[model samples]
Target: MPFVTVMAREAPVLVVVTWEKTVSASQTTTQKAIADEVNPGQWKVLKPRKGLQMIDFARLWQFRELLGMLALRDVKVRYKQTALGAAWAIIQPVTMMVVMSLFFGRFAKMNEQVGAVPYPIFLYAALLPWTFFASSVTASTNSMVVNSRMLTKIFFPRLIVPFAATGTPLVDYAMAFIVLLALMVWYSVSLSWQLLLLPALVALTIISAMGVGLILAAVTVRFRDFRYLVPFMIQVWFFITPVIYPNKMVPENWQWLIQLNPMCGIIEAFRASVLGTAINWSSLGMSTVVAVVGMAIGLLYFNQAQRKFADVI
Candidate 1:
């Protein structure tokens, strides 16, 4: 019989393995052989990250499968056992279009601002993106608290939970977009080359939602009151975002201030793209800058706060 001692070092930590051989004399193995068996691959040393580490994109990419699975789970759970199921997606924007058309277009005469475009179509186009953004933000804001059990039990990117929360709303967005196309056909709205910019606009909307959602999600872990505040914040955000009315309705002197709200330019550009109106390049550019800045800030703050999440949540 022989004894073998294998040692493996991983930065600030070291592991030692002790084994007693029961093999026959002809089948003897060396300490190096035992060490090779104990550490066959590169060690994955996970130490507590210091303040505000750069986002580990490689690590996130490795967890891509988990991200997809979490996103799929969210979509399934959202409509599970529901009567209308996905139809609620179409119904919500359509219902909102009707109400806004009656009050804003017919009574308040906001339709006049849109020129040739039909009020319902104009309203619904903006509603399409706004609905998606609102739903995503609300879901992402509460995501941390909703998945507290998983956070405590597992080890994965904390950012993935909020990021996955954004996916379920995109399902609703796609369904609602069908109704927008039908409305465009009914109103004889012609598609322009600007329609090609839609994918970019959708990305901008997601970035904006993710930016705000990350901040709120991180905060909600420490302050449960944020769960209640999220809905009201979204409602107020809807009004300031130029959803029901045209952006031009806001006076030129104050338009710059409105453009500071990232959704303002996104919704306005989305409506313009669908209705074949001239796109506001300046406002859209401003919005792009603002959205990118917000996302950077959100990521920094979320990363800094995530370390305390499991403890407080």
Candidate 2:
């Protein structure tokens, strides 16, 4: 028979056992039973997370390759079977610029509002960013539904879907931007140091678009009505933004109200960078604050809603 001893302590009780010679199968079973009674298996119960949680940026970084692949896939899918291929990117904004220049510039005499810069260059510069913003927002708004198969099949950050949607539009923006450079040269416009601010302005435009895109993407996933609403919203937004006309054309008193629109400041700053006009730092600062805050709120809502996406989507 095996000898068994027990040591009692204030903190915990310890069981000690000694075996003499070869132990029998029944004795081994008894030892295991003792061990099971003393130290039982542990289990972790998982419950749904409540409320907003911090974004797992480390996990996102771990899946950086997946994000890049998704973005590239979007770019490829955009121009895949299109007749115009990538040229459609250059054509859309350029066509809009021509029509706007004819109507708003020549007919309304808005060219004077732009001062030394020709109306074509001015309109195209604004259109470049506007077109990119509109395309990105629309694509992102539809990203969840468009990629529903992946959402149902696999697991990844839902944010990556909308974030990847921006990639296709960014490629479009680059194509259109080359045309803007050509237009600048054609109009005898000289590039200045202010052009260095282009990257910052582009970043601001992206932040604003993503802020709006995130909200719309989340809402659109549950309520499909936004599918029809987003285009009309983008159209209305284009008019409110200083895309067709210069920001200076607005009355001084009402200019502050115009500045309230995030895209207003971005478009104006973009024009200033490319056209060498005076940059409105005050308006830009307000826009920066709004963009950052909007992004935070959108992220919060999206994160909270993402838990339900696998089911809802």
Candidate 3:
């Protein structure tokens, strides 16, 4: 009989022979046979280095079904007893567009600078992505705290909680995007091939939002100050993100600085991609780099902090 035992550092093989008198092979042959039984190749090999920390990517992959269930749970629970139900998604963005168009577009006379597009549609285009980002950040930041019972009870990836929370906003974004489509039709705005860039733009938008959400979710669990800061930061963030104004008004010299703000590019990309306007390639490229860098940092920080969450939270 032969068997293999796998440890954090290595795998070793063992064998037992029933009849010692009939030992047909030397100890070397027995060891080799055991090694071959353990692994078809080299089972007796040793590694001088310490074992690596297994990230368990496959475990996360196996839990994809759980992830979907959790995301569905969030969406169902969000609008459970609300009067309008999911209509709130459409209502909120549309309402904001009207108010902003009136205040910034009419009252402030910024409408003149908004170019050929009607102010309402322009503002709606920007709001769509901003709203998604804001909602995702808020939900993700509080995900761990809200699911403490599950965190303590279940043996799943903690990151799944924040990832699931972020998913509901994506559904809201899709509903809002439909509204945007209707508005485009109402305005008689013609769609061009440029509109095809939306999927990529939307992908970038989610990555950027999730990157920020990941950082916030981890930090908020420890400091708790981030819970309050999320809304306040989003308020300031919206103003700086050119949600109500064109990046064209940002000045040529300052455009470089503005492009460095990841959302600046994301918003500009969304508007250009959906509205069939000129693509701001420089800004979009800058934003892509910024978003990717932020994601890397966020992932590293979140993974590093994940181990401490159970102890701290």
Candidate 4:
């Protein structure tokens, strides 16, 4: 401390000032503080880790609230200023159903193959799951890239980004699901025990979508070409997934190949349950197997890929 005198408007004022004496002393003080905190019992550095078991991200569990917040943020940002807002969800699937109803059901007489179920109702049922799956994949395909800054800066689970992307679409799916119910009632469709399986079927869709999305999310970090590939893939996937025409319309020999698409089982089962049609156990089982397999593979690769995300990002 030092005493100083100043003239304030011709009146003398006395003040005391305190100052750090030397940069060396300041450095010594900081070193002491750090040394005190660095005791073996006091602090330790934790390197990032991935769990050996799939779906066993313990650190991510600690941040579940963060996952919900990120999902909510995306939901708000997604339709913030849209003209129709969430109605866009209803519009996309409903429009596709109408176009298919006109061109295939009415013009081409495709409804007869699905056996007693109306084409519009048939189409909308499958649309619910497909739309959910497709949009989830699309979001995941870009999730890592879009949140590159957060990925680089944050310590949360890498899976949470793609996992969070899956949530916003469910809001859209729920909105679209209401339309499906109206169509079911309009078409005089009846519910049955099969409807009980709807939740299980939806779970499969989420798992499958997340599985595929994880792969795409990991890849999108490295390959920019996926943007174009995604649209083309979605087009091809839609045509093959029995969205417009019933899976029954596909030749019997080709059914096995189509079953290779994990969605084949989910959408078909979804349609059958919604329309009270006879269940196809083989297709459903194949799809379940593929979904689990796809999930395991995606998790394997994603875990390996995530190690480099922050570095490349």
User: All predictions: root-mean-square deviation over Cα?
Assistant: 6.9, 11.1, 8.7, 14.1
How do the predictions measure up, each by TM-score? 0.87, 0.84, 0.83, 0.82
By lDDT, the better pick of 1 and 4 is: 1
lDDT of 3 by residue, 230-251 (tens): 9999999888899999888887
Candidate 1: lDDT of 232? 95
Clashing pairs in model 4, backbone N/Cα/C closer than 3 A: none
What C-alpha lDDT values do all the predictions have?
A: 0.83, 0.82, 0.79, 0.80
Collision count of model 2: 0
Which candidate comes out best when scored by TM-score?
Answer: 1
The CA lDDT at 17 in model 4 is 11
lDDT score, residue 105, model 2?
96
Cα distance off (Å), candidate 3, residue 223: 1.3
Stretches of candidate 2 exceeding 4 Å from the true structure: 1-45
Give the clashing residue pairs of candidate 3, or none. Answer: none
Evaluated at residue 301, the lDDT of candidate 4 is: 86
In terms of lDDT, the best-performing candidate is 1
